[model samples]
Target: MTPERFAECLASLRWTAIDLTSALQCQLSWIEAMEGGQAEIPEDLARWLESLAKCHEAAGIPSHYRGVAQF
Candidate 1:
């Protein structure tokens, strides 16, 4: 996904970069790279986020993760 679309996805999901890094159990730098267009967003991740966004819109997923500390 392009950086713009990736950002849009995050907004749709009500996720900040920190929230996403926490949700995905990934490093913030990786999220940054993806957001900054320095790294190609893996297709699996793009697809995953797309599906997750749909779920989010339906309120199928929790608004935030429980028991996960925010950095």
Candidate 2:
């Protein structure tokens, strides 16, 4: 996914760069760079986001709020 998409997805999931860093076990700087459009969204990170979306779906946690993901 593009950096912009990654940022959007993150907003949808109600996650901050700090949260993603913890979840992905990556450096906060990495997440910051990705979200700030200084770096590309890695393939693995995109896949992980997709998996998180699926988990949210399975848990019956609404994925969006007003056309944006809220969880």
Candidate 3:
């Protein structure tokens, strides 16, 4: 996902970059860089985000981000 998409996703989840990084047990800078597109989305990070979204959905949470179309 694009940085904007990722940022929107975080907002939808009521999570900050620090929260996401803490939740995923990653570095704050790493998460920021990834969302900023200073670094590419690694396979592990991608999978983690996918899993995070799924977990949120399973918990009956709705996505705040509409999609790439609106973006």
Q: Using TM-score as the measure, which candidate wins?
A: 1
Residues 1-71, model 3: lDDT tens digits: 77776776676567899998888898899888978899887777666676776677668745675474752
Sorting all predicted structures by lDDT, with the top scorer first, yields: 1, 2, 3
In model 2, the Cα lDDT at residue 49 comes to 89
Model with the higher lDDT, candidate 1 or 3: 1
Worst lDDT 10-window in candidate 1: 55-64
Write the number of the candidate with greater TM-score, choosing between 1 and 3. Answer: 1
Predicted structure 2: clash tally:
1
Quote the lDDT for 3 in model 1. 96
Off by over 4 Å in 3: 47-71
Best by lDDT: 1
Give the per-residue lDDT digits (tens) of candidate 1, residues 1-71: 89998998899888999999998899999999999999999999999998988777777556569888989
- Those runs of model 2 whose alpha carbons end farther than 4 Å from true positions after fitting are 54-71
Better of 1 and 2 by TM-score: 1
Model 1 residue pairs with clashes: none
